[model samples]
Target: MRTGPRAAAVVCGAVALTASLVAGGAGTARAASCNVTTGPYQRQVEQFLGRPVDGRQSAADCEAIKGFQAKHGITPTAGYAGPLTWQTMSVMLAQRAAGTTPNKDGKCPTTVGRIACVDLTRQLSWVQDGATLAYGPVPVRTGKAGTETRTGHRQIYYRSIDHWSTIYDVAMPYAQFFDGGIAFHSVDKSMWNPPGSGGCVNMRPADAKAYWNLLRKGDDVYVYGRKPGT
Candidate 1:
């Protein structure tokens, strides 16, 4: 049976992915991918940084965005030219005009290959794939003072796509368990900071999804430092 070309629309909250329906049959129609930002926008972003805006988001553009994000302490470190990335660039441009020094990411372990970093003091997390950063420096809420997220080297042991916290009775999605019952999963930002996770790493939904993509079972999970505020 031959199926005619049909428009495909999939929406995940604010993230929308629309597939292209070319003039041909299934062979010509392109499958959809979740990409909110694009080349032209990336080129516009490059303009603010004194680079030639060729109206294309190139690999250099992606790296430049990552560099800007890292320099401005943006989270998730995703290469997309999203609102946050643009906002950071705008702020920096303004700051430069005012002759003020700009802020950047704090610190992380200098390791090879891929590694996910969880910084308690900064309340942020990021994934660095070799010298190339794959995701985040995004905001995160970890276990409270008494039950702070374990600090040390650990490896992911299990991954539960739709995990539920039996003890807390909460939904833990994209859960990658590394230390016992504690894992990296999405959580409500409202109940975080002062009183956060029991002993798990609480991430934003988007960040959690990004982490799920970047990490694999047996991957290194280094949890270190402390979130300053309660």
Candidate 2:
């Protein structure tokens, strides 16, 4: 999948683009100069975004940083290397460091057969068969602040490949309901979207489809930790 916001359009059937189209169009405009004042995480943000990593702001650097900010719905989207942006990057780095053994800490119960592990702390999800990683350490967008995704051990209770959310009126493809209305599904928005999902674990279309294929009813689903902003 494409990491940049523009890639969202490439995955048309996966995400509902009605609102994001407008936002994406606006993101094309040149960022203003007000964001020139570099914050404390300048070096880190620069390095993460693959900018020059000079620890100093430049016009090109601002544009690159702003693009990343826009992708994550970070406020201002003005390219400032701020704390929140750096914190998000840090979580991503940790997730990458986990590599294949995302459950090395054993927070997810290995006793269960064919289980799905959700690490809310890193906003990542993966499937496990015994100690083997059957699938992802893929990026995900989980529940937002007051509506945080409930943490605990649960199981897949329902499966709907093409489900519609009557409450939110949005398309939820490859949905696997594990807790109440919350499920693992694909959304039209970026997984890096700020504030997170309504409660479900939102994934990319491809990742959701993989989950749909790997998991089924009664499979264990273990979700733990708290989402960053939540």
Report the Cα lDDT for candidate 1.
0.57
Tell me the deviation in Å of residue 89 in model 1: 20
- My TM-score estimates for the predictions, one after another, are 0.52, 0.84
Query: In candidate 1, what residue range of length 10 has the lowest lDDT sum?
Result: 8-17
TM-score of 2: 0.84
Model 1 per-residue lDDT at 213: 87
Question: Each candidate: what lDDT?
Answer: 0.57, 0.77
lDDT comparing candidate 2 with the true structure: 0.77
Candidate 2, residue 215: how far the Cα is off, in Å: 0.9
lDDT of 2 by residue, 1-230 (tens): 44322232222222343335435653653354548887799999888988787889888888888888777667667888888778789888988899988998999998878999999999999999998889988998888787688999998887778876442355668878787667788866667766666577889889999999999899999999988877
Report the Cα lDDT for residue 152, model 2. Answer: 96
Give the Å error, residue 223, model 2.
0.3
Local error of candidate 1 at 46, Å?
33
